[model samples]
Target chain A: MTVENLNNINNNNAFKVPENYFDNFSQEIETRIFEENIKKQFGNKNPFKVPENYFKDFKSDISAKPKSNFAKIIRITKPWLSAAAGIIIIFTLWQFLLTGIENKNNQTGNNDSLKSKNNIVIANYQPEINTVDIKYLEPEINAYIDETDADQIYEDVNEDNNETKINSDDETVYQYFIDYADDNDYTELLAEL
Target chain B: MNAAASENKISEHISNKNFSEAFNLIVNQYKERLYWHIRKIVIIHEDADDVLQNTFIKVWRYLENFNQNSKIYTWLFRIATNEAITFINNKKKKEEESLGTYEHRLSDTLESDEYFDGDNAQLILQKAILKLPEKQRIVFNMKYFDEIKYGEMSKILETSTGALKASYHHAVKKIEKFVKQY
Candidate 1:
């Protein structure tokens, strides 16, 4: 077409700006720059990748790894197990204490019973001395009296108590012998006298 | 269950000396998140897996020492983050390279990695990220990819929020400039 005809004709090929294009031209350029900068720095892509099923198997892999001995022990020994062990130890100690106390009590009871039995024997034996035959003891008593020093016996009795004197009566002598002699020795001495 | 309730239950289980069960629960709950976090740091699937396992093993060893002062996930993240960083440092030491040289070499290896299935642009981004200072790189990945909040990150990285913000800002600027130049 001729130049004059082209100028008169409608030229749809001519460049045109969209509505308000210039109004936001600087803002638009800034936004594009921002986006382009971000894209250049950190493209919308993850460079790192994993083998397929890596995450799924990771747990098993970690679990399969051996643990430290202390960790293993910690894992194996539950709280209840430790508590139970503590309880058993305490119970064993309690039982030992109870058995010790019981044995001690048994020993004390035996000693007390032995003492009571000895006391009973002494009580039963006392009457036997009273029942001794005086007739069988008369000759021994005469011989003993012949060998004895009556003056020394009176002196010993006077030393025991200055307020009292040895009496010549047999009842007074027998009473003095009973008061001053051992159970078996007194019986023999009394029989001889 | 809510986080507090779940934490309380786990704490109860641990306190009750049910270590196996408690540990199992912990592993199931945190393995994926930790694996991803470690993977981003180490940049290799196998290394990530190893670091993740080490992190969990540490958790198993020190689970009793967890005072519950922070969220369980935050504590876990801390362990995972430290393990990843340690793994990288050890690798760098083994290679006998400076930090920048080792990171550059590691980024170079990403192309041949069988598990790295990413676009060229993504690879470029990752390489740019690796070129950053270690702390800045971590802060960027955690804040950018993981979108972990600054507060939570403070607990995990043991850095003050203000310092982390500054680090992140610097990292983003450096990364953008690098990517634009590339």
Candidate 2:
């Protein structure tokens, strides 16, 4: 064989391809190119889609969630900050409870003064009885009566026979005295007795 | 049609918004040459297919911006070359392997390659080509096997013709020594 023939033999490809590769290759290229063009066009036009007014609805959806400043603060601070907030709340509530109790006691004292003011009627005072001296002796007399036996007191009163006969003279006299006491004239009657 | 007439028709069709027709014409005219050019660099049919398709897609995208004075074939080859280099670099990075190690792996891959039906001499030639540095290998493949002129290679590689010639010469010397040893 000549040098040219040898060169030609060596130039021939020893590599092989799949059956009918060349026959179908051009067709494959066309198909791929066609698909690729479609893909490029699709890419530019956005293949993904959403419902109508999607962006408007999306804004509404985001707005629908709790967006108050307080809620936001709680959400952001929930990790460790919320514990401090809870402690502050508990301490404030305890302080409020303490102050409320103190205020209630002060109001009760004021109520007593108000009741005394309302009850004082200077026009109805009895000139015969000096109620100030009686008020000064009332505490010591109550103490002496509390120390004495009730039966002994009643026996002492009965020992005054003239006073008992005068009291038993009218059977309905006890009912009249009780009715007068109910009318709030007991202070004057006590002074007279 | 002649290349000039085809370029005019493609340009006219593209200007008229007939992209599919223009792009299809471009693919039909250049797909085989681009495929082989990419295949030689990547050394795998499947990877070559991917790079070729990517090259055409880029061409289609940048068609409007194409310089009317330059030949479409030259522009297409340039895109195919860049895409092939980029693909190789990305594949190497993904595998976390250096270019030399990747080339060695490709050499091993060629042994078991079902697509490669070359005999001992052809396989040795391929092995010798793989032993060259990546840039030299590309220069050698284009000049030695594809018989592409140094000036055209300069356009595709964006290097001077002088530099490409030197690269090809060095690659040929190395391949000769390698083939002699094998």
Candidate 3:
């Protein structure tokens, strides 16, 4: 069909919604919201909660002792700087989170989605990232990955673990991904990636 | 609703970092409005839900930057619309990348246990809507489902009322024809 005709088809339908379908949407949203709430309060992937000791960490006073000239700069830029930093941290964490998720999606071929007690298992067992961590026997996979690459990744994870002791449980998945990558045969390809 | 209480409630939410308070307040006030606005475009509850989450997340992220030049609710509606449009656009891109037509993707989605919202008629209407250009879809959604007047929408969207009204009419007529055909 022509573009005009398709537009006509869409205009003709105009997308009428079922009456009151949205009426109970508040309740459904509430349930999901509570889920988000629990996730946040427990520090389990809740995007709303900033961090523990946030008030203490973010506390600052310009007027209390601001004779210093540089403190003025700090005062003027505090809100903007903090907001920028928050955005950066959120973005960085999100990238790391998605990489973990993508690795999981590659492994096991979407099986865990059928069973989602909080949708947690989509990481860790993902063979692609795990293959990098775990030691592997396959020669073709060996030809693909250098054994040292997994060791470097392990070193990075150890550093990361020291910096942050307990993160959201997804780190458990990250841990598994590391282990899998260390042992898996195809880890060399991962280095190029 | 007491506007003062609502205002205080939002403030409390900001103070306590209580997202649920803000989320509940928004849902109580705007759930049906936002849902119908979203439902008109996406048609499926699941897609709507994902878009809705994006909308709320946008709200949470941007609430600190709210300028108060327009109502917060209107700003939220704009974000919701943008998110839905982006989602649909991305879905189309994904299908194209997978070497599938829109019809095939729709069937695959429907056959799956994931996205059906128990209303086939609603689905048909949304499929028709999927054909409209993004601007027409937005105008149609705001004017028809949400019953927003052109003037208010102009203020929200920073567009001419006449242009919006014309877009709405074109959108309406196209949808009417499509619905009539089915």
Candidate 4:
């Protein structure tokens, strides 16, 4: 028969099914697909295996309290702790600065006190002039002056006149007399005049 | 209960400051899934255990910051994935090996691992899977093994759905070619 004549044959009469085959047909197809998938994936087996009781023990292993709780607590409090520490540091620095300033002020006070003490010491200080010894030596000096040669005395007097004139021109005669004469020297000089 | 209601309960517990109870619930809920995910990535039981513990520790430490914007499981998975990848990179660095050399070494380690119980075909398939780049390997594992939806994978991986889909497709193609050639 030609290809067009072959189409006239009905193939529906050639096939029969069990009574419930159509009922489970979709489920059977799904089961087959699942089986095929399993076989393709791992030949219906898991290639990777675990030790027996591994999963059982793993739950406890993982569920045990983590040691990082302490770290978390620290992390939570870290900012507050840092702020407190910063405040402490600033306080310490401020106190240090205050102490340094106080120390500087105390040293300045000490130096000023030392200067005042030194001025008092200098003001209270006196030289030993020995006015009694000078008073006793004056009469001997006048006697020795009287025993000198008259010409020598005259030359000395002339030199003294020139010095006195220069001193009187520049300074007051009372200042010169107070500087060069004692009390006994004035009486002897007046007697000679 | 559904994930939303369960998540709500956990969130309530956290809000109440019942951290210990909330953490226990989270650990019980996600430990197996996260362990398996990390196992596939790191391929060593010990390494997976370490990464799983680290992932949970991170969850515990950061649980207060969880705004419940994303599902808790997704957040856990993200932490687990990052921890696994970082663990691998750190191991690679510690070994002072180049990427190719490190991959080779990892393959050898898989062969010698006492915990791996796969048959020869499974081993061959695993080896084929391992041939993929790291991101592709993760994508393939999440899609094929975990059977996670693209939307969930996107959230966990912080990737776009379109990009994840393309990555999965390319990964499948590569794995298929590798398996066929093997």
User: What TM-scores result for chain A when each predicted structure is judged separately against the true chain A?
Assistant: 0.20, 0.21, 0.15, 0.19
Residue-level lDDT tens digits of model 3 in B1-182? 76557656765664554443454576556655565577556655656655665565456445545654556666767887777777776676645544335534554455343434435555555555556777887776565445677777886677886567557656655665675666
What i-RMS does every model get? 28.2, 37.2, 21.6, 32.3
- Compared with the true structure, what per-residue lDDT tens digits does model 4 show for residues B58-131? 67556657876778888889999998888887777666878767667667787878899988888877887788
What CA root-mean-square deviation does each model show from the true structure? 36.4, 43.2, 22.1, 39.8
lDDT tens readout by residue for model 2, A1-193: 9999999887787977766667656655654453343224222121112235523332211112212322444444322222222222223334445544232213323322111110111112222222222222233334444565534433343353324311222222323223323544423322211
lDDT string, candidate 1, A1-193, tens digits = 8987877665655678666667656654554464468765556566678889988877633434322322333354333222222222223334445544232213323322111221122223343332222212223333433555545444545555664534544345444434533334432222122
Cα-based TM-score, every candidate: 0.55, 0.47, 0.43, 0.54
Ranking by lDDT, best first?
Answer: 1, 4, 2, 3
- Candidate lDDT scores, in order, read 0.62, 0.55, 0.48, 0.59
Ranked by TM-score, the better of candidates 3 and 4 is: 4
TM-score of chain B of each: 0.94, 0.93, 0.71, 0.94
DockQ of each: 0.13, 0.01, 0.02, 0.11
Using DockQ as the measure, which candidate wins?
Answer: 1
After superposing candidate 1 on the true structure, give the runs of residues whose Cα lies further than 4 Å from its correct spot: A1-36, A39-41, A60-193, B1-5
Better of 3 and 4 by lDDT: 4
True contacts kept of each: 0.33, 0.00, 0.00, 0.29
For model 4, residues A1-193, the per-residue Cα lDDT tens digits are 9766666555435678766667756655654454354358556355788889888766533323223322342354323222222222223334445544232113323322111221112112211221222222233333434564434433443364465222212123223323333323422221111
**Pairs with steric clashes in candidate 2:** none
Better of 2 and 3 by TM-score: 2
Weakest 10 consecutive residues, lDDT, candidate 2 chain A? A114-123
Ranking by DockQ: 1, 4, 3, 2
**Preferred candidate (TM-score higher): 2 or 4:** 4
Candidate 4's C-alpha runs over 4 A off are A1-44, A59-193, B1-5
